[model samples]
Target: MTLAASDRGVVEPSGLMAHYEPRRPVDLGATLGHHRRGAGDPCFAVEGGSFWLTLRTVAGTATLRLSPTPSGVRAEAWGDGAGEALHSVPELLGEGDDWSELDVSAHPLLSDSAHRNPGLRLSRTGRVLDALAPAVIEQRITSVEAFRAWRVLVARHGEEAPGPGPARLRVSPTAAAWKRIPSWEWHRAGVDPGRAATVIRAAGVAAGLERTAVASRGGTDVWRRLRSVVGVGEWTAAETAQRAHGDPDAVSFGDYHLASTVGWALCGEPVDDDALAELLEPWRGQRQRVVRLVLASGFRPPRRGPRMTIQDHRTY
Candidate 1:
């Protein structure tokens, strides 16, 4: 299935295009979750089954409109970074991900989930800064609060997405722009000093951090580089790696709820990070993949307590 400009609307002549056919079935929406914050994320928008991604690249900012094809996915982009965006379509869609080493047969639950969602793939954006900024905001906070802070920051500092994409689309702030964000504005956006300071520090060394994406070093090496930043720890590095490089083994060790969730899904009871690690040791190199499958399995742990309350830092 080819995607022509006329299928959605008139395609701009200045835009670049690319297509990818995955070896396995592909789910475009699920694959692109790394770039989206929530339903109305300013940086990414979903119209029906199609995705509009506003990203900042080495070349500049670009907005990509991607639609799933029966064979794979098609990408269209406009702006200074159009070529870079088009070139990244395959990586963004998980076309090159190799799963032959993953054997779900050892665990019945995993096997069932893998069978149920064969199209599941780990997308790699190959841009560490993009993932790191948001991960910092998410540190020790509820997802709703983190998302709200992200939306506020992006809306205030990000540039309008170029081309004929959705009006709501905007490119995330550049590293310099991020560094320039005033402390007062950070407060207004409900961002605490810790997360805000981490983001600022990351922006200061954005280039060095971005290099980890294309480094010949292994995932462990990349994690080490990410962790060199003071506030970036196990959970933050794992979350960044998961999206920036499709790091299969980057288990979010310090996430507030992941250990319990994984334990409940696999053992029908909550467990600590140590127990979860031991349980997932057999699939050491593919732990993230296993976790994703479990999440897709619709096996929610029984709710035993009140959910984390959304704190309004802005009020303070």
Candidate 2:
């Protein structure tokens, strides 16, 4: 990777002479913007200037190390095959020719937020299966407990990330491994049997579903197909679609928070899915982008009567 142009006496055509940094995939959640408490994966980090970055499942976290290079950047990590995953980040983040031509505007979420990142690329990840599998396990449970349950299960049964650090990142259970989890294990994980069963069933054909999704209508259509699976619903499908393909149109069908977000952003009050769709009609193909921006921009309606009800099937 050589720069065709020169900057501040820096000669052109430098072999990958570019600034690089480690941007956590989970934190890069909102169009590579902010970081959040990763569900159960210890995937977080920041380091010195480096084009190359390394990541690892160290101590129950996705430990990432970014380093700068005279001509470029490099990174590395250890855990649950972190090396292989790191290699794919460039693809997942997407590359840019001119820093300004990223066309992030079309993606309303990334509009003003698109910093003049010198070079950016998306990492190709299949972690969606891992994240969503358990997320569904708690279906209507409290996120507080849900996240805790996820941390426990992932930290326990899942493989440690392949890296040089302590137990940071953990490999999400494989479909086969998920299948082996006993009923009692799920209970301890705070997951109800029904949702757990759904996750197991979905995992059984996850690969097939992913293939069908990309092969069929890309990510959006993939969610539709996934929703067709038994036990899979709109909220689950939307959540899955968002990560499955980094889709920008996946408006969670049952997102309790999103409707209000969109409603508050588009209108001056809270709303429902129908109204949310109507308000988002202008964005059409990019409703999700619009929604993300509204959320990131801090345009949500005031807390309307406490948040949505949190139910737990595990107790049932």
Candidate 3:
């Protein structure tokens, strides 16, 4: 298999080197881009035309770098959990995502999008707290504010990554570390008390939450468990489920903009959350996939209000 010249220079242990050949082409960016908290996120990076990710795994910390090759994807990992990290490459790249249930023929736009971007698929990280914490930080805030808060808090508290990744990359903070973040630090990071408290509460029961991902009780149970956490609601749980379980149907129900965006793309009119639900019912089991198609279709509703401004809770 032909690989980038840069892949040749990496000398790693047998356990740290691995590759995944997807049956069909996969769009790494479209599938995994949501995991990036922001452009400056210390836990993720896209440099030298490759993707870098650092995670706190069950075994230990790991840094993984993925590069696409003609045959498939080449992955190299470092740290105690390198083997575990390498093993997760396929799932992380959407290898297990089943699109057989998706029938987009009912909607011409969705049909065209499905035909256009066959490589798009939802990714599963299989780490609950990792997904939930960032989602909580993002609640009720502009993306700019949430992303900035994540960047600051992670860069300040997260550990150094194990691999020879880009200088900016770091491992995401562990549950304990997240729980231990002081109030002043959260304030300094511009994460309001409500969001900060939610993250801390969830981190306290992170093991239980992570277990829900591997449980066979189904996505409904996973959603219920996630929502049980104080302050975690439909939006946060759906966002976490999308990444942690690669749940195909976990639509972001309460998102401020999702209903409107999906509405405009599907029916040429903006819709409220209730209307969006009814509109998307036709694709119940693959709603998130349809959402992805709508987003990728480049259709946007007319702006009816000013863009939400970035806010600093510290200043308030």
Best-fitting candidate, measured by TM-score? 3
**Candidate 2 lowest-lDDT run of ten:** 8-17
Better of 1 and 3 by lDDT: 3
Give per-model TM-scores: 0.93, 0.71, 0.93
- Per-residue lDDT of candidate 1, residues 1-316 (tens digit): 2323233222233348766555567777666775688777898898877889988888999999988766667788899999788767766777556678999897888999888888788888888888999999999889898888889999999999999877888899999999999999999999998888999999999999888877321387898989999899999999999988888888999887889988998888999999999989999988999998888888888888788888889887
Q: Which residue ranges in model 1 land beyond 4 Å of their true spot?
A: 1-15, 215-218
lDDT leaderboard ranking: 3, 1, 2
Against the true structure, candidate 2 reaches a TM-score of 0.71
Question: Which 10 residues in a row give candidate 1 its minimum summed lDDT?
Answer: 3-12
299: Cα error in model 3, Å? 2.0
Q: Which stretches of candidate 3 lie over 4 Å from their true place?
A: 1-14, 215-218
Give each model's clash number: 0, 57, 0
Per residue, candidate 2 scores C-alpha lDDT tens digits across 1-316 of 3222233212222121223333321223333322222433343433233222222222232334444444434445444444344444443343211223224566443465444332332223334565468548546766677777777776677765544443355556767788888888888877877888888888888677756533222354576667767888877776665544555566775675778777766567888888887877766655555565566664546765776566554575
Sort by TM-score, top down from the best: 3, 1, 2
Error of 2 at 182 (Å): 0.4
Local distance difference test values of all predictions, in order: 0.83, 0.53, 0.84
